[model samples]
Target: MNDDQATPNPTKDRKFVEALSRGLDVLRAFSQGSVVLGNQDISRITGLPKPTVSRMTYTLTKLGYLAYSPQLEKYQLDSGVLALGYAYVSNLRVRQLAKPYLDEFARNTNTSVGLTCRDRLSMIYVENCRPAEITSLRMDVGVRLPLATTAAGRAYLAAMKEEERRHVMSSLAERHPDTWPELKQQLEESFRDYEKYGFCLSLGDWDRNVNAAGVALHLQDGTLMALTCGAPTYLVSEEKVKNQLAHQLAILARDIERLGV
Candidate 1:
């Protein structure tokens, strides 16, 4: 199932193991720059009790998912964590199936093209194709952009069923309580544009220097994915993105959907 789809709360589900969830949360507290984290740091980030954080850290460290640093008194993610992500990607063949078409599209548009899917509150890039020349947005596999602000994410939201879209919006509201009002308005506009153009545009919304447009499609296995192409704001104007690139992205989405992979 798409990770974006809401699952039953582990806290309320009798069969759910809350400990596992907490352990994962502790690991997630570490990001690209914040690689090493102490128990108190994790507690503050995850809002878990200090004692619980200690226990989870110790358990994860013993399981090889986290490695404790003796000199710094902090924990860092170990290579074992990559195995989990690798397992997930190895099972999803979309990247392999979409690479050639994405490559051609990137070359034709002289922009950066990416294939991404909804992952919790963000869109995670699974495949990226770049033209020979350098581009403004430098994204690789595993890069994540906020779902409420990115073109790929907006397209994904626009393509979802109304009930699913509402559920996702409510979750976004809770996660970003302060920015939800403005984000909601932006998303409403995107939905209207999608209805008229078959795609959505994000013009310097996520990043001031970059502009992207995207279209979403469902694969043969019923997995929802988005195709996005982006370049520097000066190079790719909103008019060009909406009139030219958006149609190309929509055609690529349809081609991938026809692949039935």
Candidate 2:
């Protein structure tokens, strides 16, 4: 099981609202693959009692956060949830500010460019720009990738201060106990590469057909973000990524950092 599946018990906090947390748990139980969920399914996923799940689903349905189908006796997310996500994306100044630059870079390179931020043990894409021609790699806004495997995530790790990086690495070690040894070794190599090259490359590490390079920078608001360019492994050679794309991405990172300053 993925580490994200282990939901923390926020209710243990003094200021935590258990009901609100449980309600969110019910809403989050639905995902890309499991779009529709019965009360029992939600209960199992959230580790909540059946009665609690039933009530939460009923409330969510009434609030338009979930839509219930009478025939299948299942619930799916409604448009209201999208409004919440839209509120987040629309309010991000970094995304609004970076669009034109990222678009130009994508067109010039004929590859995909993305801006991502860390979300726990994952890197979540906030913005993505793609060239007209389609490539084997497919990434979009809101997509999440493992922090230890992707070029964007490695760049983020490299950008963090030493103490903070150590804290996050410890958390990752605890979360993915079995894979820590291998992941740590790979991360150490990435850190060394970043120090030497000003960017890090992931050649088919995250996805077998994807080759990507990325650099990290801070936004005007001091938010850490990574900008990445990616193409299919067949289309981009490792040498070209290391010697060319990495330098270009580093320049882009510096340009973005200047905007924030």
lDDT of residue 223 for candidate 2? 82
Across residues 1-261, which tens digit of lDDT does each residue of candidate 1 receive? 113335568768889987887787787777524889999898988788999999999999899999999999999999789898888777778888889999999889988999998877789888899976845578988888888899999999999999889999988888777888998999999999999999998998999888899888788777888888999987778888888999989999999888878
Query: lDDT of each structure?
Result: 0.86, 0.84
**Residue-level lDDT tens digits of model 2 in 1-261:** 223433455656777787897898787677424878999888877678999899999999999999999999999999999999889988888888888899999888888999998876788888999986845566888888888889999999998999878877887888778988998998999999889988888998888888899898787666888989989877788888888888998998888777764
Q: What lDDT does candidate 1 reach at residue 75? A: 94
Instruction: Name the TM-score of candidate 2.
Output: 0.86
Scored by lDDT, model 1 comes in at 0.86
Candidate 2's displacement at residue 209, Å, is 0.7
TM-score of predicted model 1? 0.93
How many steric overlaps are in each model, in order? 0, 0
lDDT, residue 222, model 2 = 68
Candidate 1: C-alpha RMSD after superposition: 2.8
Model 1, residue pairs in steric clash: none
